[model samples]
Target: MVTPEEIARVPKVLLHDHLDGGVRPETVADIAERTGHQLPVDDPAELGQWFADAATSGSLVRYLETFEHTVGVMQTHDDLVRVARECVEDLADDGVLYAEVRWAPEQHLREGLTLTDTVDAVREGFEQGVAEAARRGKVVHPRQILTAMRHQARSLEIAELAVSYRDRGVVGFDIAGAEAGYPPTRHLDAFEYLHRENAHFTIHAGEAFGLPSIWQAIQWCGADRLGHGVRIIDDVDTSDPDSPRLGRLAAYVRDKRIPLELCPSSNVQTGAAPSIAEHPIGTLAALGFRVTINTDNRLMSQTSMSREMSLLVDAFGYDLDDLRWFTVNAMKSSFLPFDERLALIQDAIKPGYAI
Candidate 1:
């Protein structure tokens, strides 16, 4: 059995981490205190547990409500920088070699910062964090994924913003929010624009909803990846475990090598799955689907890349090889350039796992 410490030492790549969702509770309290914002609790530790507890309510809507406090405190440029920097440092400490940290810039405009300003601040923070981590003998490469709220109508603008910042720290674009009423086709124009620009993007689908949402994301929106695609298991008929049948959509996803960004803990917290042991990742991985592990929301789920991997280790009897497979899957699925991705796989990830 691989211990948690051993898992922490492995090189990992994260694809679906949210910037605001992973804010440090202490930082939230500090920013709140400085900016005269009210928090549910004053103690950082308690506030942290409060987020976890509130998100554990087993509804995606309720789980997302916890972001209000984190987003509330991140309206300022310095606060955004701090949160972004801390996110990088924390991931570095957990041995994440590459991560695409995503957040909706529209959500941070309450404090008078323009969309471009928010992106610049976050880029500055990432650069600082990278330098600091290197000083500590840990190398981490963090990229930005600009997300537009699907419930809102700013996807086209966000897509433009992502394309504008592509040469900068930003690597891709995405849309996130409650998935039921707001279909991905609502943002079809943005996806079309992204495709025209030859830019990469992902869509949040098959999490709170079902196959229809996944179909819309892939067929209608042409998402390069599916965020929280835990619900794709709905298309897999596992009645005969020995010969599980993949429906058309499931077969297409597997045949096309579509990457499923699966967050086991977050899926359970959102009632998408019963528990880690029962998560669709086990079946999906066994079926040879391109499944990558992630910490969807670190603070809300109270998890890290290491914790997620460890949970899988316990639930699926996954050892270093399994963990390496997940890590490689994530790296291969990342929006990073081809040469850079290959270099990391050859130099960093493989060497770390071989240890």
Candidate 2:
């Protein structure tokens, strides 16, 4: 019977946050003015609501257009530095101890910035924020994940960029954007390159799309993890609420222990799952899939790690053990080296849960 307050204070790790998607509205407005980019809304709260409305608008194209506004402001080095710094503060404030911010460098080159410059700017911000958090008495570590758009043709390039920045706070690589039509197979060359380089990446699948996307990402592209893998629940037959039947995909995900980055609020916002209560997380977790809760977009979904945990506590009556499972799931699924991850679980996570 852990209280929500207790859960909020517990340390957490995030695996599926988008750098552009999580930009605060006020930051967006300030950077837009500096970069001569006019945002659709000027008021921060209104703009926040506007982004959320558009993201949940049910049209993929329209939903994607929202990023145009976010990415528009994040063109310059200052913009990246500020956004990354604020992102660290926000995540630390929400009790996130470690997080990976993913964004495509290709999208931020509109104002004549190179891939290296962008990464450098973001790293600087992360470093600054880390120092600021220390002064604020919050201990947290933030890292970057370079994302390559699946529809576009620069995944291999992005993969190389990620490898180059590994020593500079870059943790891994990912392929995102328009999961419905753009399959990961289209980026097989990039995946193969990453695989050869011994790099880690997660593919956006099993959310807006279904089993085929997940299969192609893992069976075809060799993804180490699946982002927003909410739709993997589709493979389960729950005709009787008392008993559920796990289909081939669900069984494989379960038996193979494929980590599913489950963003509950974002899933409902995108119509991937009808509601949090209807979300298959509890069932899937009970059945033993390595499921990790995440904030797909803090601005778009108006969510945080605490909010996500609160919802799970409300919907499923999940106790401390359940929270431990979720946290351990994320720690295990992280792209960090095996030894480091084991230490976090054995030291930080286990000790934190002892309270």
Best by TM-score: 1
**Most accurate candidate by lDDT:** 1
Error of 2 at 2 (Å): 3.5
TM-score of each: 0.99, 0.97
Writing each residue's lDDT as its tens digit, candidate 2 over 18-89 gives 989899999988777766788888888899999999888655566678888888888899888999998999
**Candidate 1 CA-lDDT value:** 0.95
Model 2: residues >4 Å from true position, as ranges? none
Model 1, which residues run further than 4 Å from truth? none
Decoy 2 TM-score against native: 0.97
